[model samples]
Target chain A: SQQGEEDPQALSIQEGENATMNCSYKTSINNLQWYRQNSGRGLVHLILIRSNEREKHSGRLRVTLDTSKKSSSLLITASRAADTASYFCASGNKAAGNKLTFGGGTRVLVKP
Target chain B: GAGVSQSPSNKVTEKGKDVELRCDPISGHTALYWYRQSLGQGLEFLIYFQGNSAPDKSGLPSDRFSAERTGGSVSTLTIQRTQQEDSAVYLCASSLVASGSLNTGELFFGEGSRLTVL
Candidate 1:
């Protein structure tokens, strides 16, 4: 079963605009990670935020986690055509042992 | 290999036929995982292997789906009596450390094996 559920199944925006997506999970998580997949192939790790963390940023990617609400959000600023891809949120928790369960993912399309 | 490697990038098989997909994870990585993703869908966990311990197969959808890891290295996922619904891209990932912990859950994925059952 998938632990996380992402909102706004799809999003479209113009270049230089900001894109935001949200993810909600069922169980308590120890950490949350975001990944990007292009062309339906391999996924690349983007950023990770621990439960104790409220927000983090890497490059133009900003991630915020709210353990109390069991949800997280990813924000891509200054979106580029290259940022067009499917983004997924994975939750790692003790209940799942040593594996991270992914969500349905949100597809983002950046139009130049 | 510097990264995870999977063979048979694409495979097509008829219903009732058996197929096997291989994954060679990054050297010395202790954790490996398998996931199945249908077209434009979320990834479904299939299995997980942690070092020499028993694999976690709770995610295997059916008895026909099975996997094995040898010498703590290469792993193979096998399917028997293939069905059209089984067609999907099977992805393999490896992490440097066990997941579910801080600073260790990030995964490196392979290109994946696209399986088509006719």
Candidate 2:
């Protein structure tokens, strides 16, 4: 089974609206990271939240992690059409030799 | 290097043929990873190499899939007797020791190699 899974496989929103996606994992992790992919090419790292940290913020992006629930959420505020992309969550742990296990991803479409 | 580089941006091969994909990680990066992404699907782990340590091959799907890193820099992923199911975008990434407390778990990726098996 995949170690990480994302909820709300697809989402649609207009510019200026907020978008949120959640991720769940089955194992303990040292850190959880989020990435965005455009047009199915390379991925761009977005944010990283340590397992010990509950929330993190970077500009308009907010991420929250709940270890007890083994879940995490990414919130995009005032989303623009440029924000449209596939977002993926990855779980990293020492047991995996520092390699990350990625989720299927959530496809987000921000309409102008 | 400016970033991770993948060769053969696109490849097409018939069933039972063999193909090889190449990846050159950012200079000095110790960690390199390979992932496969099928259409409308998430990235699937394939392999990982860190410096001189033995690569972690747990994510490889079958015996026909193999990868080797030379001099801890460039890597090659080979698939023998390719099948249609092997068709996907093969992505390569590199990072600086992504695990430890001091390291941030960020991966820099290269434009993937699109592989098609017919």
Worst 10 residues of 2 chain A by lDDT: A92-101
Off by over 4 Å in 1: none
lDDT of 2 by residue, A55-105 (tens): 999999999999999999999999999999999999998876788989999
**What would the per-residue lDDT of candidate 2 be over residues B2-111, giving only the tens digit for each residue?**
99999999999999999999999999888999999999999999999988888999999999999999998999999999999999999999998765333685899999
Interface RMSD of 1: 1.0
TM-score of chain A of 1: 0.97
In order, candidate lDDTs are: 0.94, 0.93
Question: Would you estimate the TM-scores of all the predictions?
Answer: 0.98, 0.97
Looking at model 1, residue A108 earns an lDDT score of: 97
DockQ of 2: 0.68
Error of 1 at A105 (Å): 0.6
Residue-wise lDDT of candidate 1 within A11-31, one digit each (tens)?
Answer: 999999999999999998889
| Interface RMSD, model 2, angstroms | 1.6
Q: DockQ, in order, for the candidates?
A: 0.83, 0.68
